[model samples]
Target: MTQQTFIITGAFLGMLAIILGAFGAHALKKLLSVEQLKSFETGVKYQMYHAIVLLLLGFNYTFSTSTMYWCFTIGILLFSFSIYGLVISDAKGKKLKVLGPITPIGGLLFVIGWANIIINAL
Candidate 1:
């Protein structure tokens, strides 16, 4: 993706993180257990962190790469979104077991994304 695309995606993800964080704090608080709420918050935090990184990469083209962009983008989707799914569904009494595995795969992507930066710097 281009720098513009990264910027836009980052903005969108950041915006969504805020919205979800609010929703989790307000609406979900009553519906979820303490552990579930904590897990949801973790997703929001990771999403926001990567969203900021994406914005940085977008602004500084020298630091941006296709692999890095894809890794973060897809990682957020898989990791954060999976946690959201797991927590929400578990709250509703039917947790999706499949998403459990997907979360780590997403985390692996995040690790790879960061590793890419370190490797490129060296």
Candidate 2:
């Protein structure tokens, strides 16, 4: 993706993270348990973290960014979205067993992304 696309995506994801965090804090608190809320917060945290990373990647174009961008994008989708799904489903007494493994894979992608950046830097 282009730099502009990465920036826009980052901004959009950041907005989403803020909205979701607020929704969890205000609306979901009444319905979700403490553990579920924590899970949701984890999703929000990682989303925001990667969103900032993406924004940085967009702003600084010195190193390779495509791999990092894709990694962040896919990682956020898999990790955050899966957690959201898991927490939401669990709150409703449903379990998404399949998504359990996907979160770590997303995390691995994030690690790979960061590692790639460091490697490129050196």
- Per-prediction CA RMSD (Å): 0.6, 0.9
Task: Give the number of the best model, judged by lDDT.
Answer: 1
Q: What C-alpha lDDT, on a 0 to 100 scale, does residue 93 get in candidate 2?
A: 86
Per-residue lDDT of candidate 2, residues 15-110 (tens digit)? 999999999999999989998999999999999999999998888866647899999999999999999999988888887888999999899989
TM-scores of all predicted structures: 0.98, 0.96
Q: Residue 21, candidate 1: how far off, in angstroms?
A: 0.3
Q: Which ten residues in a row have the lowest lDDT in candidate 1?
A: 56-65
The alpha-carbon deviation from the true structure for residue 34 of candidate 1, after best TM-score superposition, in angstroms, is: 0.4
lDDT of 1 by residue, 1-122 (tens): 79998899999999999999999999999999999999999999999999999999899878789999999999999999999999999999999999999999999999999999898788
Those runs of model 1 whose alpha carbons end farther than 4 Å from true positions after fitting are: none
The lDDT per prediction is 0.97, 0.92
Quality of model 1 by C-alpha lDDT: 0.97
Steric overlap count per candidate: 0, 0
Which stretches of model 2 miss by more than 4 angstroms?
none
